[model samples]
Target: MLPFPSSSSSVMASSYPTRFCFNRECPDFNRHECYRPGWRLRNGDFADLCSRCASAYEQGKFCDIFHQRASGWRCCESCGKRIHCGCIVSASAFMLLDAGGIECLTCARKKVSVGPNFRPPPSFLYQSPIAEKFNDMSLDWSSSARSYRPPNLSGPSILQYNLHNRGDGYEFNQPTSRDKATAYSTEKQRGMNDLMGKLMSVNSNNHSSSILYNQKPGPNCKVPTCPNVNAYQPLISLKEGPLGTQRAFPVTTPIETNGHLGLDERYLWHKANSSPLSHLHNDLNSVAPLESKNLNFGIHLDTPGKYQVVPRYCPKVPYKNQVLQNLSNESVSVVTPLFEKILSVSDAGRVGRMVLPKKCAEAFLPQISQTDGVPLTVHDSTGKEWTFQFRFWFNNNSRMYFLEGVTPCIQSMQLQAGDTVIFSRVDPEKKLIMGFRKASVAQSSDQETGLNNNRESSTNGDAEPIDKHPPTEKKKSSMTTTRSKRQKVEKGDLSELKLTWEEAQGFILPPPNLTPSITTIEGIEFEEYEDAPVIGKPNTGLGSTYSANGRLSAEQDDEEAKDEAEGLLTSPKSTSKHPRHRNGCTCIVCIQSPSGASPKHGRRCSCTVCDTVRRRRETLLLRKKKQQIEIENKARKELESPNSDEELRQSANNSGTTSKNHEQRHAPPSKAQIDLNFQPERDEESLSPSNTTTKDKSPHHDETSCKPPSSSSVHSRHHHHKLHVDFADS
Candidate 1:
């Protein structure tokens, strides 16, 4: 507990030190010594008032600060006295409007006692039936009875209205206040017993404990000598059991303290009367024991928040390899080892010898002749067969049988120490099937390197410090050596072909030997010419086709050219020996004509074949030109208008007009000179459908007149061209 300050102490002298004056209008609010003197001395409490307020209090003039100001304290609306807001008893004390003013804590309680909804506290009803009877007989057993006073009810119910409704701004009806003296006297006369009786009677039927509190002694009571005990019927039993069964049941009468229930008494009574919850309690004896298999699944993962339990351990995963069968059928007579053995270093190192186990030799080699060496074949892991000479030998010292000559097979499989090797006899005449698994690093590398390392370590034992190097460096060096050796073998296998001169050039004779020097003839045999005068034979009148050197002369060449042009001889340029062809040119000479006659040489030979070819070429050129024109026209039309109704109509008309123009252009003509200029103009103008329609009408009107003039003009023009051509040639 905090120590209480004496009246003379500075704390009591100025409780609210350095605090502002309660009155806003006070001039001493900001001063250091603003506390009113002697006020605390008289009341044994610190004062909130300043010197000016104290002076006003002495002059019999009320300062508005006392009534209007709230200094952690408020003025009671009825008494006009300052009361601490924290000291308020209930919510009803402060929930007041300014016109109704604030009711003091004391007034608020008095008003609550007389309110319509107010009910007497549970402690007031906790009086034992014996105590109530004694009170009715006017016999007080305790000093509390004499000091007890009735609750005040005569005061106006100003603060009694519902405070909850005030938050919503609703008004409540209130009774008018009476004169102070009369109100006090009338309130003192109202007893608490009358109120308690009314509350008890009203709630008796609704509560289960009412009968207990209200029970009276019956005629058969054993405690009749004690009036209090007889009146309460202490020996009486209820349905479940006697009231004496409750521990400390006689002391259950509740005592009120600041409106709080007697919690200890109430709890004790409730514990004694309450029944245990039978359904909710678990029976520990019936629980099953934890199982091992289920415990594996119950283990949770170490990860946070996830809390996922591990799956059950499964042994089937590792044993799944047992399902695989041997290479040969089980029905056949075979030697199949149930388990493979790891090859040792001494066994794998030799390339020309092998030692077989006694069991393998006895099972597979029993029929072999003792004196003869047997040729055996063994297949490796990849199914590649290797032939080796095998012979069984019995050691005279050990008296053990062993098979030999597996070196080739072991070398082919590249077995090393710690590598597992298995053998199965698929066929007696064929090869023994062999399979192998690569050695684990720890087993192979450690065993092989340990020997080499030991030797090197022994050699350098005194040369270097023990901590000079680490084992990792030795391992790296060994690995690099192995890698280099492997790389060399790989390079040899994968390297490009190496070529020699004989193989690449496909000849073996030396360059100088192939070109031997030619030796000159020692003498020429000369025939003695007869001295008789040689007379030239009379010249045959035929022109020499070639000179003495086997070449044509200029005159002979000219004759050949002329003959070729005439289609009477073939030219030298023509490779074919046909007499009609010259310089690869196709003419009547080269092509067979329809008439079956020999062709005459000319640039413009009028043979049936030539004429037909010429006509076809002309028709092809015309058709190509027409197609090009149609493409250009279609592109132009598309550019001028997109696909629309007008374009469609225009296209339809253009198609019809184009057909009519084609018919007119190819129609049979009169035997007259055709108007070439007019024909070209008409063709060019047909691209525009609007213009073609206008030109088409004109053609229809002039058809009759135009034909006669065209015929006359054609005849005159042909006669003039023939006269001019004849004059120039002559």
Candidate 2:
């Protein structure tokens, strides 16, 4: 007979006169015969079965004999042997694989070789000495508990919590199933009632209470009740009752059990307030192995709201030194500064080499007599170790040290040029630690001041004498003071500097009246200014535009002023063509008549603007005449040559025609040419006042006139005379 008679069992005993085998397929299922307890049920009572079925269950072959044709049969991934998965009896026979599919215990043990970190499941904790051989294999008992479900049952899934005899006493397995959440409330209530009844009976009479407790052991006395229950005294006796039935009783004082089981006033308080497994479940995977030498457990189960059993494999308590070291490393705090250097473009580039200062390397680093220095181990701020080739090269009869293979470290920190890296040494170990400071906007001014100070100290042979023990804050303040002094000196120099009007005028010039000629040099057209540059003050506000860098600010102001002056001179209206002139109006024409006036200026008009325009036109025409004279000379030379062929005469004629066309395209009209349109009698005017002839008749002109004036030459004489006057004036 069981210790605790469930409600259903009591009702059945009262209603039915006889009992039958629990298995429907048994031959004696409905017969009034002796039966034995088989598997545990959801109601926390054992199923009564005949001797035959009970014998098979004890031998772990009940599923093979009775449930052979059940639906949930699966083949082992390794052995190809079928295992019944639909029932709870064979739950521990297989293990689930991470890749999907199941592996039998034999195959699983062969694959997952146990290591020092492997932990046996809770089921193996209470197994006998014979089961110790299997300790090398770890099983996922929780997965098996989750996968098992009673066949054809609509109630909640059955949780398998096995009990194994360890020679001295029977020990309950740890409840690995997380599904206990569904029955926790009911289980807790039932456990409390049983505990109260036991306590009341024990208070009444100790010997009688022990007997009643042994006769009616609690069904809710699961593994989670008292984790260390076996440590104090065995809760169940190995001695058998009548018909070889096992009886469980509190071998020690029941009061001690209440304390260990956490069912006293404190336990009730914790139960109502907090859950024991809340934090444990979250940190389950992070728990370290109990065999670790560095592992420490600081948790105390006696604390309020901490009734949960802390496993041996809980998270380790970190040491004080380790915690402090971790914090310092994360913050990148340097203990002692050996030397520091700002990374140049080459050092930060993919070249993967860092140049070290000669003085600092000789003073702090190991003495390397050889050019190919030793491989040095360096630790970064994060305590990550790196190997760098510390070599030296000869330069200008001196040795220059370099650290090769620093590209990985530099890239890991995302450092670039202008960033400062500090070489530091920590005490005790005297290990070299490398730290870095990223370049920021505020550091730009400080960098220049620091460089100047370093140079001065190096020259005075006092670089090694500076205080090395000052805190970082003191060093920062000193750097700031130096920067401020440098800035003040620069400001004082700018405030005292002044420039006169003439001195300032030398920096900029007014736009000239003559249009710049375009000249192509190397496929780029440059505006060639031929006239004398006009010196004048710019309209830009130079006084307000002055900055800390006075020279650069002044240059910027000069450029701005030149652009504004040029914009005022080259107005769109001035560049546009006027009805009077053949080409676009000149700057002088626009200046004399700001409005769109069209009355032509006479050749005798001698205003300064008119004179400048006339001289410019004459210069252009003279250049054209010179070019024509050169081309005629070349043609004459070619035609007079003794070896001249017919092709040479034709080429001379072609060259003459081309020169005439080019002159017509580029030559500007003269005052006389403009006047001839209004007064036709002026066409016969002579170019030279010495000859009072109707025209300055050249040999070419005479030849052209005798030809009866072809349509193309009708205005050739007038055009040539016009070009000559324009060229001379220019």
Candidate 3:
């Protein structure tokens, strides 16, 4: 049975009913489960499910089950965070482990150093073999924010608190199936109807439910390819925005005066007085498992308003590291050094001002629109309950955990005028991340990636605060080192995370093709004759053209070559085209010479690439023929020679031929003619007196004794004789 509001007004009631849940309609609600004689149910006490879930909750009695979640607590043992639960935890598992002496599902352990200055809380009730919880509300959570050696705080969590801050309502909880269909109808009212097909995600729109990254989308999200992927980026300058400060794009005057947003002191104080509860959530492990039907309980601060709604089901994934990453959403929002101020006012009359959202005049599907489906207004209960949507915005909704201090200066560590924080929303709705943060440290390496290059002296906005104390040595539960474990916890499953709204910029509308009426190359720029002057040469200074990060600066490249450029338009003056002049024709010698007068004989005018290819092919073919004939002759000699058997045996030893065998196999023969008289065939013209052999000597490089052309300059004629002679000689 789920816990319900006590007959008492306050959520944290001391005495709870034993037998049954107060909500009579609930099917599983127990009636007389914990009927202790001394039970006193009150309005301020936690009311239902006390008697239903446990008499004593012994070991293994549905121990791994997760129950609903709650908010508003104190410091983490690893990271200095104040929240109800440290991170995502399993209720059933916590109970089971408590009985088994292992309280933390996360594989971590700690030892607190007892100093006179270091005092344990007076009401130290929560403790397990792994983690000890603080019961006293007076304990300053900020002091424990890792200031000591081996700072006793949980590492950064992967939880995100419900910024909507509604209690037990759709404003804070995930939406139900009924809510989704209802939201379907209102989809027509949105500005982006093109994006409003049937969008669905694993998680509903609410902060109470923790979500891990899931690879699927909601049932209604559009299926079009991302419009931002392949197209030219919007010509907006990455450098020209409001630098070193974090302010959204609605213009306003400088600080001190009541700014254009009208964020005055009156509104700030009213918010503090309104909600008695400081709602909190974690992103790291606070996510509820998807299959489990556990309800997550966060402080829905709108006690005076109408009923808020949240999703009926939220799934949990692991945590993620934030310092080194950003969601691949629409143009990644550059982290401004100064955090932007966003205020969530549920009561329009109470705040007394209207926020003017610039009409989404342009077309880029950023998550936020003028409507309520965005983080500014998530219908906690799966979009079913429309009126009870939770409104969220960036720094406007900060959990107590985000306020950890550099103690001794705890009082001085209030959020000042120029503080900023960046956040990513993961909404698979399967897991309930209470509030998790990935620790990030600033480094020069970030500069090379073109990430946050415009950031100034105060870089903390661009970088997340790293864990002040990284754990040393191995943890007991097969957990990696502290940093690695924390990193894994923070980087939740992304496959499950789907964009509720997206406008992809990658697609480019193709241009229509047209046939040319005339063909010409008159305005081209290539050759430089006497009539035309050479303009720009390729610059050899690779360094000035690029940064160390390998990003070539197109602007710099253009500046260096500006003198040589020409344009057909009047704006950019066109330069004279390189002149193409004809040269007079010459004889074969002139053509063959470097002057290139005649194409017939000039090497310069010939197709050098084709000539090289033909020569290579001819050489390869000749080599193949010669090798084949040598093999045949060698085989025949082995069959006839008397010494062949002994030679073969000797060659077989040593796993190869000996020097003598190699000499016989590869040696060129000396010219041998034993008879004084030569028998001459008609083919052997040199031997016939009637046909005399004439030798003409020409001086040439020893290496390049190209075949004596058949007395012709043609390449084909020179190789033909070589081929015929080799074949005949063989």
**Predicted model with the maximum lDDT:** 2
Estimate, for each residue in 677-716, the C-alpha lDDT of model 2 and write its tens digit. 1111121222233222223222122333222111111111
Q: lDDT of all the models against the reference? A: 0.26, 0.34, 0.20
Q: Where does model 3 exceed 4 Å of error?
A: 1-28, 33-47, 50-52, 56-62, 65-133, 136-449, 452-730
In order of lDDT, best first, we have 2, 1, 3
Ordered list by TM-score, greatest first? 2, 3, 1
Best by TM-score: 2
Residue lDDT tens for model 1, 204-282: 2322332233222222222221111111111111112111111111111111112111111111111112111110011
Our tally of clashes for model 3 stands at 136
Q: What are the clash counts of all predictions, listed in order? A: 1, 7, 136
Q: Residue 42 lDDT in model 1? A: 15
User: lDDT (0-100) at residue 687 of candidate 2?
Assistant: 24
Model 3 residue 579 lDDT? 8
lDDT of 2: 0.34
Give the lowest summed-lDDT range of ten residues in model 1: 721-730
TM-score of each: 0.16, 0.22, 0.21
Give the per-residue Cα lDDT of candidate 3 at 258.
20
lDDT of 3 at 37: 15
